[model samples]
Target: MQTTQIAPSNLGVTHPLDMLTPQEISAARQLLVEAGLVGATTRFPRLLPVEPTRELLAGYVDGDDDYDRSVLVTLLDTATGEAAEAVVSVTRGEVADYRVLPNGEHPYGQPQYLFEEYERAQQIAKADPRWQAAMRRRGITDTTHTYLSPLAPGFFPYEGETGRRMIRSLTFHRNFEGDNAWAHPVEGLICHIDLTAGTVTRVEDDYAETEPVPVPLQTRHYTPEHVGPARTSLKPLEITQPEGPSFKVEGTHVEWENWKLRVGFNAQDGLVLNQVSFRDGDEDRLVLHRASVPEMVVPYGDISNTRFWISYFDAGEYLLGKNANSLKLGCDCLGVIKYFDAFVADDDGRPVKIPNAVCMHEEDYGILWKHTEFGEAPQVRRSRRLVLSYFATIGNYDYGFFWYFYLDGSIQMEAKATGIVYTGATFPGQPNRHAPEIAPGVIAPVHQHIFCARLDVAIDGDANSVQEQNVRGIPMGPDNPHGNAFTWNRTPLTRELEAVRDANPETGRSWFVINPNRKNYVGEPTGYQLIPMPGPRLMAQEGSSAWKRAQFATHHFWATRYDPAERFPAGDYPNQHAGGGIGEWVQANRSLENEDIVLWHSFGPTHIPRTEDWPVMPVDYSGFWFKPHGFLDENPAMDLPDWSSYQGVPGTDVDDAGCCRH
Candidate 1:
C-alpha cells in the first residue's frame, strides 16, 4: 500500500490515542458472540455501544499520562422468542461482566440490523404481483436496477417495540447501459420490514401517476462514456521542508507557532482536541479545557411515511470515527501535512486500518496587518494558520471538520457539508412542500444540517465569567432628539437559563468569556469574544418529533457550569431517545459567574435543493470563532518580521515561465 510522506506515525501520533484500536475492534466483535447476542437466522443482534465508556474516559483526560484499558460494548437482543437491550463491559481484552442501559426498550438506528433488513426487503418486494407488473410495464430488466437504502422509520415500530422494524425506500435506476442510474427514477415505492420476522409486512406501492415517470438516463454528467476533461493547473506549487514540519508532536500533544494542544480520534466523534493553550506572555495560558463536535443532526423535511420522522444524529447514529475518510495528499489537504489513522471492523468482524483519517498543516489565511504612513515604507504582514481537520462520510453526505489557530490569537472552528443529496422521485409538476426538482421524476427534499460544538472555556484559570453585551440604538425620548446614539448594555448572565439567550440580530449581541482576576497592561480584565455566525432558523416546527428531540437547536448559544456528565446536547442515544439532555440539564439553573464554565454553540443551515446541486453539491459552510477581544494588548502577530525586499516577477508573473516554451 502507498503511503503519504508525513503520516501520523512520523508525527509521533501513538496508541492510547483515544480511538478504538484494531485489537479493541476485534475484541468487541468476539465479545458480542461470546456474550451470546450475535445475530442468527431467527435471532437478531444490533450493536448499540462500541466505544469507550464516559465514566472511564474522563479519568484518563483529567489525570496523568496513564490510560485505563476498558471498552463498553452494548447491543439489542431481538431473537425470535426473546427481546431486550443489553450492555456488556469489555476490559483488558476479556469480557468482564454486563448490565442493561435502560430498563425495557430497544435502541433505534443500528446500521447492521438495518442493512440485513434492507436486503430482506429487496426479496419481498420482488415477490409482489403488482411490483412484477410494474416492472414489466416499465420494461425493467437487469439493466433497470432496483435497490434500497435503509431508513430509520423515525417512530416506534408496530405494537410499541414488539420488535425492531425499518422502512426501506426503493430506488430504481437505469443501470443496463451505463452509470447514470441516478438520472432515472422508479417513482414512489417503499417497503416496511420487520427485523424479527425477517419479512416485509407492508408495501406502500402508491401508483401516483398514470405511467411511471422516467427521467433521461443518458445525461453526460453521469454517463461514463463522456467523462469530463481534466482541470489542470500549469504551475504546480508544492510545500517543501528542508529540515522537517514546523509542528512538533509528542504522542497526542501537538505544538506549532504559539499553539499547543492534544489531538485524538473518538469512536463516536471523529476529532477531539484537549487542553488548548496558547503562548500568553512568558508562559502558555489555557483557553479552552476541551473542544469537540458533540453531535450533528440532519433532518429531512418531507413528512410522509417514507420521508417523515427521518432525522439522523450523525456522530451518534453513524460513528464518525468508525467511517473516517482517508486523506489523498494534494486534494484533501495541502502544504507539509501530517496524517492520523484509526481502526474499524470489516465484513467478517476482523479489524481493518483506516489510515490518514486526520490531516494537519499550515497555510496563509490572509493579511495579519497592514498600514501606510504618508511617505514612510508601507508596513504589512502576511497571515498564517495552523489547521487540523478530518473528514467523515455518513451515508451519502460527507462533512469536513476543521480547527484553525491564527497568528492574531484567534481560534476558528468550521464545518463544510458537501456530497450527493438524499432524494426521492416525483410526478411532473407534483407540489413539493419542502423540496425542489432537479430532473424529471426526481425531487431533492428540504433538509437541515445542524452542528453543535462543545467548548469548555478555561481562561487564565478555571474561574471565568460570561457577559452578554448587547448593542442597541437609544430611544428619542432620552438625551438626544434623534435616536442616532447606540448604547451597549453589558449584562452578566448569572444563571444557566439566563445564558440560554437567542442570537439577537437587532441588538448585535455577543458573549465575552472573561477572567476577572487577570488584567492586561491597562488594568482591564482580558477576555475572548464568542460571536455566533449568521444562519437560518431551524425549519423543524414545534411538536415535531425531531424538534422535540433537538430542543437545544432552538437558541444559538448556551453557557453552563463545567460538568463532564453533561457532554452531548441531544443525549447519548438520540435515535428515539426519550428526551432529557442539555435542554433538561439547563433546568438545574446553575450559576455561571466566576466559575468553571462550558459554552455550547449551535450552527445550522437549511438546504432546499436546486438544479445546479445535482450529482454532487458545492460545499456549504458554517462556522464560529473565538477572537481575542481585550486578551491581547495589540496584534500579537506584530512580531512577524516585515518582508522588506520581496519582489514579484514582472513579465514572467503575468504569464508563466513562457519564453523557452513559446
Candidate 2:
C-alpha cells in the first residue's frame, strides 16, 4: 500500500549532501589540498641566513646641476630579521637645463650588447613576411589628377614699351589717451601691397624698429558705401532717463551659441591687446543680457586693460555659404564692443571723408563686441580684434589675438597665441624610448623621456550649448596609416576576437615570445617556436589550473622619480598628474623551451608612508637581478648555471633568500 507524505516547513533538519553539487564538493576538497590547509609545510636551510644585515637604496635625479639630488633608503626585513633591498628616490634639487649632464654621466648612452642584438634582429626582420605586409599596408597611392592650376593669373608682356607701375599703400591707425591714466602708447598699423609687377613687393616700415611682419596680398576690396547702412545706429537702443541715482535700464541679451569668439582693442597709441575664447555652452547661456554699460570711472588709459572687443560669424552659415551673412543684410554684426572713436581728418591731408563708422555691442554677462566697416579705401586698414574668455570649471582662460586682413581681396582671420602652464612627464633614462612601440622595427628614439602635464579648461555660459569645429589630422584608414592613431570601434568582444584570428592566424596562439633586449626580429614569418615543458597549459588556461601550471620562474622590482613640488606651477594643463612619478617595469627577456624567462619583478604605485618619508617623501627603491638556471642536457655547456645550488661563502649572509628559495 502507497502512503502519502507531507513536508514539514519548520523542521530543524539539515544534511551535508544538500550543501554543494558533486563537482563543487570535489573542487572544494582540491582547493584545500592545494592550499595545504591540512598539513602543507615548508622547510628552510640552516647554513643560509634568512635575511641580510641591512637594506640599501639608489637612484638618479634629473634637473639643474646644483638642484638634482639622488637618494637611497634602507629597511630591515621584519620576517627574517635582516636588511632587505634598500629603497631609492631621486629629486630635482636646482633649476638648470634638463638636457645638460652635471656629473659627466651619460644617462642615454646605448649599451653595446643592446645595440648589437638590435642590429642582428633588424636583419631577421628584413625577411619577415609579416613585416613586409605591414609596410605594404602603409604605402600610399594616388587616384586623382596630379596637377592643378594656381589661383592668381600670371602677368603677360605689355603691347607697348610702357613700364608697369607697382603701387603700394600703407595705412596706420592711432588712438591716444591722456597721460593721467595709461602710460604706454598702443599702436595698430596695416600695410597693403599692390603687386601689378608679377610678384607682391614687401611693405617696409622705415620709421619702426621692430621685427618684420608678413602681410598677404589682397585680391578683393570693399567700400563703406558698398557695405550699405549700419546694422544698428550709433545712438543708444534705449536710454533710461533716471529720476534718481538708482534707476533700472532695460537691455537686450544676445546669446552666441557655439560660436568662435575673439576679443582685442586698439590702444591710444595704436597697440592692440587681443584674446580669443571659444564658445562651449548651451543655447540658454548664449543669450546676451541687456544691461547699461558700466560707466568708465578712470580715463580711457586707466581702464583700457579691462576693456575688450568681440566679433564672430558662423563659419558654415556665413563664410562657406553661397548666400551668406553680409554687411549689407545687417545679419553679420559684431557681438560686443567696449569703446568707439570717430575718424578725424589730418591737417596735412584734405578733408577725409570718413564714410565708415564702427559699431559697439555689449551683451549682459561678460561679453563685448565691436564691428568695423569693411570697404575699399586709399588702402585697406588692417583690422585686428582681441578676445578673452575664462573657463570657470578648469580655472583657465584663453587669450586670443586675431589679425584680419585682405588676402587676394578676401578677408582672412589669423590666430596666433600660446597656452598656459601644466604638468609634464618624467622618463628616467631616455625620453623618446618611453613612447609606445607600434611597429615591429620602429624603436622609440633614445633621447626621449617621460613628462607630467596638466590641462586647465574653462567654458562660459551653458556648458551644453558649445560647438566643436576645425579639427585636423585624424587617421581613418585600414592598418592606421598614421603611425600614432586611435579609432572608435563598436563591436562585440567575441566578434572582435574572431576578426583578429581571421586577420592574423599567428596571433591566435596561446603564447607569444618576445626578446625585449633585442629591438626587432629578423626572419621569415613562421609559427612561434614552442618551448617543451612538463606542465598543464598555464598560459592557455583560464583559472587556478593556470596558476598551478608553471613554465618558468620570474621576478619584479619597483623604482621612483622623486618630485618635490606638491603642485605644478600652471595647475594641470593636460591631465599630467595622472600616474604621478611612478613607472612600471618593461619586460626584459623571455624564452620558452629552455626555461629561459628572465623576468624583472617590480612594484607599482602605492603610498605607504615610512618614518623616513615623513615631512616629505624620502627615497624609495627596489630592483631584481636574475640568477639564471641550467635546463639543457649539456648542463655545464649552457650559458646559465643552476642558480638553485648557489651558496654563499662561510660566515657570509644574504638577505631576500626567501624570494628565490624554491
Candidate 3:
C-alpha cells in the first residue's frame, strides 16, 4: 500500500528490498555447490552481477515486492581449482548456464569481506601476545575484543594474489552514548591475516616511538564542579501528513509533480538513482541514466607503514552502504518521509536488512520566486524540493549523501562528511603539532575525502554533445573600445582529452551537455549546465601513492563516451590498482562529438582538524549541480503562485489603512 502520509507504521515502512534477498543468495551458493564448484582447495564463493545494467523496475504495485524479472549471477572462482569469475544465469528459481568470464572481470560485489574482519580480530587478539597486550592495555578482555575494520592494504605486483591475503589495520571501539562502533581508536596497530589459510600472518604492534593510544567517546563527559547533569528537555516535533503525501510511491519508483526516478542500492556505491528524468511540458526528457559515487578515495596525510600506506577507496575497498547506520525520525530527517530499505548478504550468505537505508521527502526550500516594485508589497511563493538521501559510517567517518530535485528542473548533489577521525597514539601531553590531536596522546591524521560520481547523460536523446563555456573579456583593439565587454566563448569539446579541464577561477567555467537536435523558442539548443561548488581537488604530488592510483581525482570534471564496460573512473579492482582507471581511458582520447557521453564529476573536502572538530566533527559539505542552460524559454520557477494574498500584514483593508491604529 502507498502510504503518502507521515505515520509511524510498519505498513507504511516495509517495502520489498530492491537488491538480491537471502533466498536468492542461498540459491546462488547452492547452485555452485551442486555443480561441485566448492572444494577445500578453492576460494570462498562470491555471487555477483555479470554486467552493469540499469533496468527500470517493473512498475511498482500494491502488496507486491519489486521483483527483478531475471538474475545474472557471477561467481568469483578464486580457488586453485578455478581462478576466473564464472557467469551464471537464473530465471524464476531455475539455474540457467555457466560461462568462464574474461580477464579484468571484477563483477562480484565485495560486501561480506568487511564483516569477516571482526571474527579475524577476535581470533588474533586471543592468539597473538602483542595483540593481546595491546587489547589488555585498553582493558579489552577476551569477551570484548571487538575490532574496527582495518584499512584495506592496497595490492602491488610484489604482493601477488592479494585476493587470498586480507590485511586489516585494527582499531578498538569505545562505543558510548549508544553510538555504533568507531567512537574510539586503538591506534598504531595493524594486523595482516591470510584469509585463504585463515591465520594471522603478521601483527604490527609498534611504530616509530608511538604507542597504541586508545581514545574514548566522551561527548557528555564533564566536571561535576561547574556543569549541569545530562538532560533532555526538548519538545517533540511531528510531521503529520493529513492528506497523504504528494509524491506517489509504487515500490522503488517515486513520482512527484514532474520528477520521476528509480532508486536502488549497491553494497559499495550505496544509494543509486536510475532513469532519472523530468517531464518537459508534454513529454519526459532524460537527464541521467544512472548516478552514484563509483569511487571514493580517502588518503590520510600520515605515511607510516600502518597509516602512510593506507589509501581508502571507500566505495570499492569498503562497501560504504554496508556501513550505513539505520536512520530514525526527528534525528536523521523530518517532514513527510517515505523510506526505502536496502538488502545485502552477510559472510554466511544470509541476507541482512539495512532498514531505512534511503529516505525521500519534500521540503520547503524558502522562496521560489519573489519580486516587488519600489514601495510595493512583494509577490512571493515558497520553493520546495524532493530530497533523496542516505549516509554511510565508514569506520571513523560518517558521510551523508543527498540528491535534491527542485521544482524548477535543477538537480543539486551534496555530500556531508562528519564523525571522528582515525588516530595514532603519542606521549600524553606531547602530541605532535603537525597532526591535529583529538585527545591526550592521540593524533588524528589530516586527509581528503575525494569522491567521483559517474553520470550517464542523455539529454532529449542519446546523440548529445558537450560544450565548454568560458567567459572571456574582449580585447581593447580597433574602434577605440574599452575592454569592459565579455562574451561566453562556447567551444565544442570533441574528444576525451578536450573535456578534461578544470573549473576556471577567472571565468568560473562550466560544461553544458546539450542536444543539437532540440531547440527552444529562440533557436538555442536545449541543455543542462554542470556547475561545481568550490572545493580543493586532489593535492597529492605526481608519482605519490595517492596521486598515482586516484589520478581521476586530480581534475574536478570529466566527460567520456558512454561504454557499458566503463562505469567507474577508478576501475573495478582499485584496492592496489596502479593507475589503470580513468587515466588510461582518457589517454586513448576517444572521439566525444555528437555521441552518447557520460559526465564524471568529483567534489570533496580536505579536512585539517581543529580543537573545535574534536569529540565529533561538525558536518563539512561540498556539492555540484545541473542548471538549465538555454534549455527553457523562461524561468520554470516563474510558475510559483503569488503569495501577496497571504501577506499577514495589517494593511489588507484599504479604507481603514489611511488611519490605521497600532
Please name the candidate that would achieve the greatest TM-score relative to the true structure.
1
- Tens digit of lDDT per residue, candidate 1, span 81-155? 233343433343345555554423543333333234445666666666656665565666563355555655554
Query: Per-residue lDDT tens digits of candidate 3, residues 327-416?
Result: 753246655567777766554444578878888877778988777889998778888899999999877788999999998899999999
Candidate 2 is scored at a TM of 0.14
Task: Name the candidate, 1 or 2, with the larger TM-score value.
Answer: 1
Candidate 3 matches the true fold with a TM-score of 0.82
Ranking by lDDT: 1, 3, 2
Candidate 2: residue 210 Cα off by (Å) = 58
Q: Model 1 misses residue 583 by how many Å? A: 1.7
Residue 594 shift from truth in candidate 2, angstroms: 51
Residues 48-82 of candidate 2: C-alpha lDDT, one tens digit per residue: 00110111101212221221121111111112212
TM-score of each: 0.83, 0.14, 0.82
Worst 10 residues of 3 by lDDT: 653-662
Candidate 2 lDDT at 589 equals: 15
Give the clashing residue pairs of candidate 1, or none: 143-176
| Steric clashes per prediction | 1, 89, 6
Q: Largest lDDT belongs to which candidate?
A: 1
